[model samples]
Target: MKSINGKVIWITGASSGIGEALAYELDKKNCKLILSSRKEELLQQVKNNCSHPKNVRILPLDVTNFEAMPQKGREAISFFGHVDVLINNAGISQRSLIMETDFEVYQKLMDVDYLGTVAVTKAILPHFVERKSGHIATVSSLMGMFSSPYRSGYCGAKHALHGFFDSLRMEHEKDGIAVTMVLPGFIATDVAKNALKGDGSAQNKDDDATKNGMPVSELAQKLIKAIEKKKMESYIGRKEILAIYIKRFFPKLLHKIILKSQVR
Candidate 1:
């Protein structure tokens, strides 16, 4: 197993939720952290909460600003001279039916969830290639592997990540680069509250499924374990994770079950 202790890790979306939890967890493991998000103030808060605050650096980044990612990547690498791992956790969710959703909402979802990740990965890829070592771990939802009502855009964006990252792994395996796709079923966080509506507005309210999802701390532990083991794909969640297998062998039944669940 790969050891992350003493490794410099960069995490986008570090202002809250899974990213914030990861900062605390990794700090406990003696990992150097570079935390990024559009919310610099919140990133500072997360940094201060860490046990080894001195080892954490806050780098504010807006993932949707595609053109700025290369510079951001350079800055991230400069934090401790090199980044050993990049956790692509910056993403937004959708909470509207496809018909009701505006075109811009879909565009925003693609920009933030799919292309933004591609941009950042491309930014740091050269460094990884040159050093012949690196790990790319992304937080993709279970929705990426199957269909769900009101999450059409989210599913599409996440699915695209799998395709792109899978190809990256294949093309760069000889370079000693590692790729891990983290498929989370659900975790108690503000994802639903921050999800976009049909008109590209934040939902601003929590849903039942999300409110009762796995705790963020538990997910963080599992995520670290997946990274340490260098897993190509790790599904973390409750019963919702079964959807991946069901979608593979019993697609029709999975569809019926999803519909019956009525999880918004």
Candidate 2:
């Protein structure tokens, strides 16, 4: 089994869902964790639950605050002396059609889900490059690889991450920086309820499919293993992962079916 003992990992969006669960799982392996999110209270709560409570520290931050990330990352590095891994998992979901989405809404999604991740990654890249070792793990939706209705902004943001990070992996391979792109199907997170609608309001409710999706704990476990093993890419979830295969081998048929499917 892959292990993360003695490694220092920085995880964003650690206040809830997959991020919070990952803190618990990784803590058990005695990995020093720097947990970040907008909610300081929630981050503290998560830190308290870690198996190695003393090894976990909270660094509340808003991912979109690009100007502040460099200083924040320096603070994070000071917490553990060095960071071996960075998980860019903080993101918001969009729940509106392309035509219905406002320009600001789309921009916000990109700001948080794409540019936000990019900003943080860049802030920490020098550290990894100097040391010649680091890992980057991010959460991307399956829709990122295959577009679906009612999630145009979200898909755009997620798809952008694939393009940016995939290129970064190639360029940084010589620096010993590993990038793992995690594609999750339907995860049992509050993302649906928290998703933004066309008018910039919360969807304020969960979808049936999301309610019955994979548990947060399970996804966290799988992600930790992926990072430890330095896997290039991996997908999590139930039946949704199969869509990647269908789109690859049966593109025309998949498109026809998706056009009529009930995604929203």
Candidate 3:
């Protein structure tokens, strides 16, 4: 649409990082918000910081709970009649070499990043289809576009999202639905620290590059502009964002750079 003003938006993973920044940014635009995350307290904190506090509501949820998604969808719709936009920003990251990674660790990444997103999308699709109008924007990663070391599972999950959402866009184009896949490079978030390790434990610390990446608010602002314009996709970051372009025209050069880069 033209702007987020007065439109009802549902954002998952609103407790922090990009999701929280989005809530604040859109709130300033007068958008009504339904924020969800596993941490209700943190979600509330985010809601409190919104420009229009009255326009924000907190709904805690775990995206992996597929069975409960229908009820969650109903609750979300009841809160705002019908959601005009759904931001699927909830996901976890993985940081482990495949050979050293545990199978369960890899599975958890798929469960949280891929299947969880699918579950939320499936839950909301019926409403969008019935109404024949809605926007689905998701936060995938730069790794989704290009592979990286020690992130096999994370890359695989993000790659799966690209495949699934690309197909969804084609299938639902006639239904007046739109899908925007956002590919974010390293932002100043604690995702690296909280990412899953090979033993199913938290990495509990940020990587060097991620720690010094672009500011979250800046990325959030740009992403909001892209959403307002209904752009099909937008890539964000400073240096890392270039990887997506380089991977396209100079695949060999990109591989050589990645091989020598200290991602971990």
Residue 53 of model 2 has an lDDT of: 85
Q: What is the C-alpha RMSD of each candidate to the true structure, in Å?
A: 0.7, 1.2, 1.0
What candidate 1 gets wrong by more than 4 Å, as runs, is none
TM-score each candidate.
0.99, 0.97, 0.97
Candidate 1 per-residue C-alpha lDDT over 187-235 given as tens digits, one digit per residue, 9 for 90 to 100 = 9999999999999999999998889999999999999999999999999
Question: After best superposition, candidate 1 residue 47: deviation in angstroms?
Answer: 0.6
The 10 consecutive residues of candidate 2 with the worst lDDT sum are 1-10
The TM-score obtained by model 2 is 0.97
Candidate 3 structure, TM-score to reference: 0.97
Clashing pairs in 2: none
Number of the predicted model whose TM-score against the real structure is largest = 1
lDDT of 3: 0.90
Write candidate 3's Cα lDDT for 1-264 as tens digits.
Answer: 787778999999999988999898888888999999999999988987877888888888999898999999999999878999999999888888888899998888898899999999888899999999999999999999889889999999999999999999999999989899999988999899889888999999888888899999999898887888888999989978889889999999999998998678
lDDT per residue for candidate 2 within 16-74, as digits (tens), equals: 99899888888888889999999999998998777678998889899999999999989
Residue 244 error, candidate 2, Å: 0.5
